[model samples]
Target: MMAGPRPNALSWLGLSAVLVAVDQWSKWLAVSRLEYGNPVPFIDGFWNWTLVHNYGAAFSFLSSAGGWQRWFFTALAIVISTGLVVWLARTPRSDWRSALPFALIIAGAIGNVIDRIRYGYVVDFVDWYVGTWHWPAFNVADSAIVVGAALLVVLSFKSPDTTGKGG
Candidate 1:
């Protein structure tokens, strides 16, 4: 006897679309309203809005490697986003743990790819700091990617119950 047809998580793409819209809108607003390199304090000492352009990967990796990094990162993001979409297609609809993260990552990857293709760099604006130390400036896309990747890591440890009795 074959198992019944299982629904897939492709519907989760809706969430991806919403997140991508938000990421792009926030980037646009930042580019329109924020001054480059000038920080506008949000929380006095902990957060600020500072516009910056990233020509490389996370933490501005390979940012100074001249001009080739732009296309490289763009292509890389496209490939990764494609893979995540395929994975989501194969995942069970009930598995929100996997589906949610996959959707988040897809949104983030596509959002940044749009920036790279249009501007040759990703727009970053949010800045967080404490005292003299500060985290690298980033945007909504980066936040989604980080949160999605972190969810993947944390969820990986949750093992499904093998016993007939559902836990």
Candidate 2:
């Protein structure tokens, strides 16, 4: 039997809303409560809260690129988010494994874009790592993006016959 109408659009919008809310809230709290680089340990060495402003891409790729990267990254995010929205709209909601990741990525992208536009940088917190090998500071939006990307990688490996085939 043919599948009913796809719920991709609804799922995308719903997930995006959740991401946006959580991302914004966390950023707000980070800015209001945490001082820059002052680690507020949650589990002492495993996790901590700290505020950081990233003006460039992941791991501060263009962070020291003489400041032009701010607008460049912002524009890139807008373009990417637009494309993801279109992709999400075209995808069938029944394909949850695929659509869900796309929605998450789109939401995460939009969340960072909002910060870039409003604050000129993304506020990062929630540091995690071992003794000295600290992971770069990041926020909820980054987490969503990373998770979504991981899901996409997993979905990419799934057999076509297995996807969207209810067990």
Candidate 3:
């Protein structure tokens, strides 16, 4: 009889849970404590807490598309989250480099999905950049997704499994 594949060591689900909790808590704080567009400086020139609602994808991609984007984004998020969960389950726990990113993406997707389902948009804050060239406002969930993507890109290049090697 062959033994089952070794289970993953890292808890991708647990990491995802933590990301969701932190992301939601941060959004709650932003909504309750800050008024929209009003900057509450946290680092004077580097960071600020400014509440904003995004009705579309990254950088407000479809925010001005007249309103069809709400459902579109919602559906996309659902699909992405589902796919991430499935991938995470199949990934070995020892593959933290890959699994963590998937977990973060999953958490971020679910977090934004909650907002879209509840308010038809995602709440964003934590602004950064120079005086006239400000980056789009975003929340903890967005941050996780971006960081996770970057990490995934880096890991893909480093991992032989991802690079398609066999011996």
Top model number, TM-score: 1
lDDT per residue as tens, model 3, 38-131: 9999988888899999989999999988878988988998898888877777777667777878888888888898898888889999899787
Better of 1 and 2 by TM-score: 1
User: lDDT scores for all predictions?
Assistant: 0.92, 0.85, 0.85
For model 1, residues 107-141, the per-residue Cα lDDT tens digits are: 99999999999999999999999999989999999
Worst 10 residues of 2 by lDDT: 158-167
User: Each model's RMSD to truth, in Å?
Assistant: 2.3, 2.7, 3.5
Each candidate's clash count: 0, 0, 2
Lowest lDDT 10-mer window, candidate 1? Answer: 158-167
Residue-level lDDT tens digits of model 2 in 1-167: 99786565546678788889999998999999999989999999799998999988889888988878888988887888888888877876667777788878888888998988899889999899899989998888898899999999988887545544573
Please give the RMSD of candidate 3 to the true structure. Answer: 3.5
